[model samples]
Target: MRFTSHTTSADGITERDFVHDGVPGVLWTPGHDPAGLVLSAHGGGRHKRAPGILARAHRCAAAGLAVVALDAPGHGDRVRTAEDERFAIEIRSRMAAGQDAGALVAEYNALQASRAIPEWRSVLDALPALGDRVGFWGVSMGSALGIPLVAAEPRVRAAVFGLIGATGPLVRAAAAITVPVRFLLQCDDRLVARDAGLALFDAFAAPRKSLHANPGGHGDVPEHELAGAVTFLAG
Candidate 1:
């Protein structure tokens, strides 16, 4: 995963408001010229502007990577258009109706995932025209979402998973990925504790994988650890 750098200005914080499963998002490149693209996912209860993920996007793009900070189905601009106030409520409501919460979220995710991956991938597909390689970067819930993309997609040469070490869905993804991976978490993270995330990291089937811990809450991956993520994606 050799990522290059280039300068970029956010094309726009456009909402996929009109497109089916379209996610409103920011599209930007960090440095002078980018070497790759990072599909960014935010943490639980948060949207794509999450500080930690954005910080890494700075470094990645500075290193020449295009960044697409994703707005999960019920997040960002999408949250505004959601029939409900938030995705959690929507999930809870569906579950209350005897709908499988996980299945519903997965269905919602599946519908939106393809739209997103290709949005970022389209940037990557066009990257050769710009001269770069492409990959993904995600945190907390976003990292959880990245599991499927990393597992089944061959285009993903590298992945950065942080702020989240595990999830209910991740239990099944334990050995699904075969790509090089770098995982990070907070030691006393109330949101994602060291133990649980570590357990998930242990489940990775990648021949090459690494993990690091810092002191922080669930909201973001700390500044000190940002280098580690960039290093991982850069690796």
Candidate 2:
């Protein structure tokens, strides 16, 4: 894991960019012994540095938690294939036509997760300094990939996820995730079906889990809710 760039922010946070086995990612450190580490994933059409993800990383870092975010397959610096491009085009078409695209989106998410989960495990293998208490933060496409990840990775102690559904292999995957989960569900998510999201929350086998339903459509998550997520991750 060779660092490509390292810079310190005025607020005493250190941001470092690196690549391991061709996977590009960024790490935010608070310049002190971290109590925990949060591994983050971004939604479709968003990269590791998307404003929402960056804000979460910075918020966690300020609370003395090291946060790391990586680009999902076909996102950020990853080379986008023809299939990836076609899928994006189809998503737009289906949404514009008022079609139920959840199944299609779920299939794409499953394929992406197949590659993403292993890559994240590889990240944990490469960065042993991220501490033992690990948590995950992922939204929409991120949650789709992250659900299977937290299920398979015992290193993850808790998770902040939701905004996707139990449509594909994810239905089975969600059953295996037993870590503490704080699920964020937008009441009127335009991209995700409300019933599917609620059903996905119901599928979680976590002994401790909570559903945070907000009154808004997709991408309408409020700022205060983001702060709540930071608090959840920091725990």
Candidate 3:
């Protein structure tokens, strides 16, 4: 299926391979200040181009926020082996484990356990500017990666976690983050349940933060969340 995309931002998208400290991933720059950045990780079985990824990145960049969305080590441009060979090996094996949300959850868990968060920190270390005035906006797995990175680094000024909540490994580390945060929810969603996110929100120590329920189902939430983030980060 073909996904629709457009490039209207004054700062159009620039695709490049960035390798820092042995970790490599494609970086999509939506055109904003290099000093202030937003790093994203897509949901499972997804890439940086997943449904709302790039467009939202573009919107954020248009809004004066530099946006960076990276593919997980095995997804999108980061696929380990040639498509045929890579899928023949990993796909057959991983699918036998059951290819569903449960499987995705397991994969997400394993990625966390294997220290993906530290790899992101390594990316920040590699790019000095990536550490400045950064606010994080992550979808499903992106939230997982952002939570720990933000907590471990004081530079993340504010964050918006889309399709996520206060549970999971990311949420487990939220308490360590003293910065402001925001969460989006779809009342009828199945990916990341509304209730779980609520539990997680209540757990965060951010003196300032709240949840917004969009009128849609799972996946991309619209502008209100970002507007709240601007206020949080600006303060």
Leading candidate by lDDT: 2
All candidates: CA RMSD (Å): 6.7, 1.1, 6.1
In candidate 3 the C-alpha lDDT for residue 163 amounts to 67
Worst 10 residues of 1 by lDDT: 12-21
Per-prediction TM-score to the true structure, in the order listed: 0.70, 0.97, 0.73
Model 2 per-residue lDDT at 196: 83
Tens-digit lDDT string for candidate 1 (61-141): 666566766566556666444543455687778767876555545544454445455555543444354344456777666
- Native-referenced Cα lDDT, model 3: 0.62
Task: Report the lDDT of model 1 for residue 159.
Answer: 84
Model 2 agreement with the true structure over 1-235: per-residue lDDT tens digits: 8799999999899999999888899999997888899999999899989998888899999999998899888999999989899989998899889887777788789889998999999998887887898999998999989999999999999999988876747778889998889998998887877888888999999889998999999899888888988888787
* Global local distance difference test of model 2: 0.89
The residue-level lDDT of candidate 1 at 147 comes to: 72
lDDT per residue as tens, model 3, 1-235: 1112333434465556554544455454545454466666666567767766766665555565556566665667654545435434564576576553444453544464355667666665655654377777775667666677777778677877656655456566777777888876777666666777788777677887777788666754656665565455434
Better of 1 and 3 by TM-score: 3
Model 1's C-alpha root-mean-square deviation from the true structure amounts to 6.7
Against the true structure, candidate 1 has what lDDT? 0.62
Top-TM-score structure, candidate number: 2
Q: Report how far residue 162 has shifted in candidate 3, in Å.
A: 3.8
Alpha-carbon local distance difference test for all models: 0.62, 0.89, 0.62
